[model samples]
Target: MFEQLGLIGCGLMGGSFALALKRAGLVKRVVGYSKSPSTTERARQMGVIDVEAPSALLAVSGADIVLLAVPVAATEATLKAIRHLVSKDMLIMDVGSTKRDVIDAGRRVLRDHVGSFVPCHPIAGKEVSGVENADVDLYVGKQVIVTPIDRTQPEQLQRAVDVWQKLQCNVVQMAPEAHDAAFAAVSHLPHLIAFALVNGIASQTRAEDFLTLAGPGFRDFTRIAASEPKMWRDILLANRQELLEQSQVFQRTLKAMEAMIEAGNADALEGFITQASQLRANWRMGPKKG
Candidate 1:
């Protein structure tokens, strides 16, 4: 077990990591810090953290493992804050949604200690935020993507992977840029589309009237729109380049459907809808039998 875990950002992601570590008995104690005092206090009360640190540096002090679970935009400043406390033997990782920007921040702030940094993104979370909603099983069975940089220490990278493995996470490795690009399509773009669709309807003068008659499909599609706004805003902007590309691809599909509906082309519309339905149905069915 790691002697101590230094967790920065005591929000949902960070809080959940600490709980997972504790539940797995992989970490002896957790020292946590958040810019918001209330969050740190809440985390301590919730037992997500064993110690509440007043500053980021203090949080990492005497800790062998450090996790920065702050937003992608705050990576630079947060890393700069705790860089001095980082050591060669320490394992530093982040649960940021976008990796390239975070890896860039690590390069800028981590400097000599960059080898200890392993950029990670756990493909798990809910529509809610904060320590109050943190789940101990958040990472269990989730895809924990580790994007290692050239300067990453091989042993340290494996140690980071092991930590997640012990938590029952399915660890995967990829380049930082590729992680950013892939997640932008699957995770980031969906959130953006959800927000856009919800807002588009809400922007109409009769939005409230329409929403009152909305059903399960609308509720399921727009559930993500209720997610923390500032977090999604940061995610979209950080991965804007990749997200823009994904958005264009989605727009093309949308245009094709739009044209089919406009022309009342029954055969073409059926084909268009059928393809998507078949793909989604197959995915729901999981792997094919041998």
Candidate 2:
């Protein structure tokens, strides 16, 4: 059990972490801070946090475990604010979708104290965001990737894994680079495609008319298009290189299928479709090393 959990951000991810920790009886107190005062106040009013900290530094004043649930872009500033109090004894983690940029920020801001910071990406969340939508079960049974850098303290890393495991999360650990590359292929690129797909259709003159006829397949495929714009924008930019590489691979495959269609080669097109269908049908979700 932790004496205090200093939660920064106080949005859906942060608030949900606090609620989950409280419900699991792992944290005795939660001190939360957000860039928006109203958000911090709302989190406190909703019982997501025991105290509303006025600043990021104050949030970690006496916290043994700290969670930075802010956007990837704000990581450096957040770490700079709280670096004065960061110590090897504290187990600090972030829930950013991208890891390399966050690790770099921790290294730069925390310096020698970087060992206390463990980069984490929880494969969980809803399309909608904010403190109001925070749910206690957000992390339950979710695959949380803990990406620890070379400078990370072993004891603190173990503590992070333990905390997530206690919260009923299937925790997996990987190096920061590997984590970024793998997620770029599986998560980031998919969101990018969904966003582009929606925008491409909406750009047409019959955008509204086309949407009116969209069925479950279109809705399901473009579900991630409704994700928080700012958050996804930061994620895509942060992991742009790897995401671009994945995009190129996807384009190549798409072009191959398009070529078959253009040539009117039914046999080749059918074979290609059958192969893709079989591959997707045989795919099983689970944690595997990068």
Clashes found in each candidate (C-alpha, N, C closer than 3 A): 0, 0
Specify the poorest-scoring 10-residue window by lDDT in model 1.
281-290
Off by over 4 Å in 2: 288-290
Clashes of 1: 0
Q: Write the per-residue lDDT of candidate 2 for residues 1-290, one digit (tens) a residue.
A: 99999999999999999999999999999999999999999999999999999999999999999999999999999999999999889989999999999998998999999999989989899999999999999999899999987889999989999999999999988887888889888889889999889999989999999999999999899888899999999999999999899899999999999999999999999999999899999887866546
Q: Report lDDT per candidate.
A: 0.91, 0.93
Stretch of 10 with least lDDT, candidate 2: 281-290
**lDDT per residue as tens, model 1, 161-237:** 99999999878899988988888887889999998898899899999999999999999988888999888889999
TM-score of 2: 0.97
- The TM-scores of all predictions, comma-separated, are 0.96, 0.97
